[model samples]
Target: MPGSGVSINALPKVSLHDHLDGGLRPATIIELAEAIDLDLPADTENDLADWFTAQATSGSLVDYLKTFDLTVAVMQTHDSLARVAREFVEDLALDGVIYGEIRWAPEQHLTAGLSLDQAVDAVQEGIEAGIDRVAQAGLVIKIGQVITAMRHADRSLEVAELAVRHRDLGVVGFDIAGAEQGFPAADHTEAFDFLARNLFPVTVHAGEADGLDSIRGALFDGRALRLGHGVRLAEDIEIGREDQDNTYVTLGPLAQWVRDREIPLELSPSSNLQTGAIAAWGDDMLDHPFDLLYQLGFRVTVNTDNRLMSGTSLSRELALLTDAFGYDLDDLEALQLNAASSAFLPLEEREELADAIVDGFANA
Candidate 1:
């Protein structure tokens, strides 16, 4: 509804790549930190949010990741985890997200004597509470937890097992996050193999801090059903002009496989720019490979990798794309449909979600 006077926030959307720890409310962080007497870089909520956004936009994935230290520090206990999870759902509901998959590393929430199962249970409790709240507010929203393992850590197999054990509770999928450069998905072979054998869904953090090789490992080693910010896959494409008014494009094997298979690319515009994932293209949104990838038939879905860090929502990301690429309502609907198809849900549920998105967008 571009110029039709409809706000993007009112449209139903699906969020596939949001991070749980990365989407904490700054005010909640302040409150939680006070109970634990945890030191913070800023005391005020606004100031702390500003600090996180500043740190995240430093154009280095390593530096951007450091901001998580503060958010994760406050999420060690059961109550804090549940509170964060609840608020995460509430915030997404406000942003018009009909469905969302919140990913977080259960291994990181173990500093407060929480067992792996205990952490998962706490998050599920929070999620259920949030869902009830949303229903009370006369809105419908669905959430699923995508348990993650730190790529640099050696506990991926255990985390994968944790996800499988909790699959019926609330957990939906598995992911290996953190550094994606040297610690490729190959390092977590046992975990990925186990997930595959169990028929569990997976999405790996690749093509963000690394190139096509990392993406390849994600496919071959991790067997990722989706690529978390697979922006760097564009590196495998070569675009050239064939004439003054014509152009030609060639896709490498990796890019071809991803496109042909319709593997979703969880492209986070602000997060990608902040982490320098699209630095080869440029710093601006227009330089994003999103438009190119979309035009080239890649199943590119919009996401907010870390809402707190990037200061964004799924709606805002879609609006940014429209502004940068002159997209209309149909374009936005296509992106949401991509996300709906990419969700880690049963085929019937995904179809229902897709129908809901279409109906919502049509009414908008």
Candidate 2:
């Protein structure tokens, strides 16, 4: 009973790449839809969940992203946003996430007449309520908001200012999400420069839909401390094999810079597959470059990019990685440690998070 009785749910974890808009509960979506008199793709919760999963498996990032229309449709109101944020944190806590950074584009949620500040405030209120509720239950969890701008939109400079304005309230960092291919980080030069001038931290959505050039823009233009779904950085790696046991791997300048700088890669195994980020490698989880990047000493962290769409929890993602890569608890701990260190919190706060991960994993 020793190992069988052990609960993977009790393990400490960190979530860095989760999207707030993409993690809506199926039940909540149904209720919100009913209140707003909106027709859903499916009437029942289970069917809706399955529909989301299927739609997300389109094997193309743009196609996969279409599933967000229904979700974002329901999340236009301040009340709905608050409720979703609160439930998102509770769900992560239930999944054994001790710390999480939730990212979402504010401009997308303003269709309901709520200002950007109001939207962020509503989410913050929900997050604080969730934190207090979890603390009352004798469980500790911390969450921060990453204000995201839509890369395809032209409001990044305004969004970046909004993030910096709310830094002390609930926003911990800034990000640019949405279509990542053509809307390079360079397009948001003013925004990035403002963030840099204000000493704000950033994590860019690079190396997911595009390749190393996108990543280069994120670093040189956006000054990103982390890369959201930076899985495509593997393309910069060159492998040679004289024999099965003598495989030689070499990193190009871009890959070497990323690895040497220790830029944390928020690798979402299931989401990456669902969105076809790893299609170049293959169509299986085993084909993901996560192991290769980790082996080469890149700061690789596991995440649930879209819990509802991907039908995954952080624990489930970790389990999948463990199954595919033969990772023990030590490897799990290492991933959490990397996330803790890479978080956009203050130096002391990050250190405290690292200590918590170390202590929790030790006891586990």
Candidate 3:
């Protein structure tokens, strides 16, 4: 997998659950921090990157989330948000992501006096700029915005309205993020209802920091179409093993629903390990439930939940998985197909993306 030498980078991919704030370049964070005169956890970019990785490795959901405070602190201004979004798209293109849905909480970006509309517009502008840049370079890429509301905050209804208002411009979906443990999706029932009434596609961050109950709330209450890191849904599986080749498996009600419905789980291998989302399974990539889910016919797609923090790209994550699980190009293509099918875009657009992935991997 390692010696493939850019094969992974050239293979087309679909990104379903990458975060805009969490994917900021470390150097950009330094520059943005300097502009705001904010003190960062590390003085140098290298140290800052290391600090982020360490913080996320704490195995406690709260400690893992603390790293976001620094990233969000510098993203308060319109210029900062625009720059981050632009670079985010460019980074995705470089990682061979043909299409991506970038999710971020607009409510968090309003501290600099920018209205919710202005924040969403700024990101749209950046996304357009990045698309133009890629086109100029003779590479094609597409991106859509997933406007998110912080679940712990009280402004989800307003943010949901913002997302619906900008659907035609660039926004493609709505999500509830932040503190998945205490702030259940039920807490944002108003926002969820607003989104549901508007018929906007919704993907909720569930089963990462919480358990099956949180995931249940996300589906039944939030009406989520896709699950963000629903890795912990593995908790519902009871596996009984014999010495050689004989293993019994039983799925709980929640797991049965997710698998029966083919709900896509955005499985970020490195991020899951760093955040301890897979702690109940094991401490390494081999221990992830991704293979289990895949074998069980659950829709599973690989992702880099945070590129900068995890020091990964979509290509790198795929390569890592290939190395861990002995997956060939066929396996990779199936994952891309899963992501393309689960995208919030129209059916025609999703089909186009799926075709591109097929052609790219066929050539690779």
State the lDDT of candidate 1 residue by residue for 1-364, as single tens digits: 3868899999999999999999999999999999999899998989999999999999899999999888999999999999999999999999999999999999999999999999999999999999999999999999999999999999999999999999999999999999778898988899989999999999999999999999999999999999999999999999999999999999999999999999999999999999999999999999999999999999999999999999989899999999999999999999999999999999999999999999998899
lDDT of 2 by residue, 298-318 (tens): 999999999999999998998
* Model 3: per-residue Cα lDDT over 110-214, one tens digit each: 788998999899999999999999888788899999999999899999999999999999999999888888999999999899899899999999999999999
Q: Per TM-score, what order, best first? A: 1, 2, 3
For model 2, how big is the CA root-mean-square deviation? 1.4
TM-score of each predicted structure versus truth: 0.99, 0.98, 0.97
Worst 10 residues of 1 by lDDT: 1-10
TM-score of 2: 0.98
Off by over 4 Å in 1: none
The weakest ten consecutive residues by lDDT in model 3 span: 1-10
- Alpha-carbon shift of residue 239 in model 1 (angstroms): 0.6
